[model samples]
Target: MIRFAVVDDHMIVHDGLQAMASRADDLEFVGAAETPDDALALLEETRPDVLVLDLRLNGESSTELCATVRRRHPDVIVLVFSAYGNTELLTQAIRAGAAGYVLKDTNTGRMPEILRELVRAGSYFDPRIAGSLLLTSISNPSEPVSFSERELAIIRLIARGANNHDIGEALNVSPHTVKFHVSTMFKRHGVHRRAELVRLAMDLQLLD
Candidate 1:
C-alpha cells in the first residue's frame, strides 16, 4: 500500500479527499491534519509515502512547509491539493521539490492514479493546469484561468465558508479588497448572489 496523508484547514476538504482516496486499493489514508504544524508533527512520526496538502492553512505558509518536507524527509512525495492555480506559486512549488500540483477543482476520481504515477513515474502534474511542467510542447489541456492570483485566493476562502470579513482577516487584506474581489468574481460569473458563485464554482470545477 502507498501510505498517504492529507492536510487542509477545513474538515470537509479532508473528508472529501479521504473518501476519494479510499476507493483505490493501493492508496491508504494514513494521516490527516488541519494545520501546517499538525501536518509537520504527523510527518515527523509517521513517515508516509505521500502527502496531499493545501496552500492556505490558517496563517502558515504551505509553500515553505512543502520545501521543508522535501529537505527534511526526502522520501515523502508532496502533492499540493489546493484551490490556488497560479504560475508563480506552481513554479515555486516545483522548485521547492513538490512531486505535483493538482488543483482541488479537478476530478477527485483521478487522484488515485495521480498518486500511483507520482511514486512510479517519479513526478506528475495536473494536465488541466496551465503552464504545468508535466505537459509537453504540443497541447495544453487546462482552460486559461482568467482571474488574477489574488482573486483565486479569495474565491477559495469563500468556498471554504469564509465570509467577507473572515476572508479579509485571513488574507491580511482590507475588507474592501475582499469585497472588491467578491463582487468582481460575481460579475464575471454573471451572478447576483453568493449562492450563485458557489454554484458556478462547483459547476466549473473551480473548487472541490
Candidate 2:
C-alpha cells in the first residue's frame, strides 16, 4: 500500500479522501491534518510516501509551507490539490519541489492509478493540469526557452536578480561568459529584456 498523509482544512474533503483511499486496495489513508504546523509535526513522526496537500489551507500560505516541508523532509513526495489551479501557484509549488498538482475537479477514479504511479515511479501528473501544461508548451514552442544544464544554472542565479559580474564571480566564469549566457537566455525565452527573462524563468519554474 502507498501510505498517504492528507493536509486540508475542510473536514468533508478530508473524510471523503480518506474514504476513497480506504476503498482502494493499494492505498493507505495513514493520517490527516488541517494546518501546516500540524502537518509538519505529523510528518516528523510518521513518514508517509505521499502528502496530499491542499494548496489553500484555511488562511495559511501553502507555498511557504510546501517549501518548508521539502526542506525538512526531502524524502516525502508532495501532491498538491488546488481549487483554482492558478498557474502562478502551481509553478511556485513545483519550484518548491512538489511532485504533482490536481485541481478539485480531478477524477476520483484515477486517483488510485495516480497514487500507484507516484509510489512506484516517483512521479504523477493530474490529467487536467497536464492538458494546461501541454497547452503552455505548445503555445510557447517558438518562445526561445531551451536551456542547457549550465544555462539553467545561470538562469537560476539570474532569477535571484544577480548582476552579470556578481554571477560570473560566484559561478567562477568570466563576466563576458555570464553576459553571453544571459543574452542567450533572453533570445531563447523570446524576451527583449533581462527582467522579462527573469519573470519568464520563474513562471516556467526554470528558476526557483
Candidate 1, 8-68: lDDT as tens digits: 8889887877897778878888879987778889998888999988865774447788888
Shift of residue 48 alpha carbon in model 2, Å: 0.4
**Model 2 per-residue lDDT tens digits across residues 1-208:** 7888999999988888888898988888888999888999989877998899987776444877888888999989998887644444565678778988877777777788877887788877666556665676688765543467777777777668788888888889999999888787654444567665555555455664
Which residue runs does candidate 2 get wrong by more than 4 Å? 137-208
lDDT computed for candidate 1: 0.75
**How good is model 1 by TM-score?**
0.63
Residue pairs in collision within model 1? none
Error of 2 at 91 (Å): 1.1
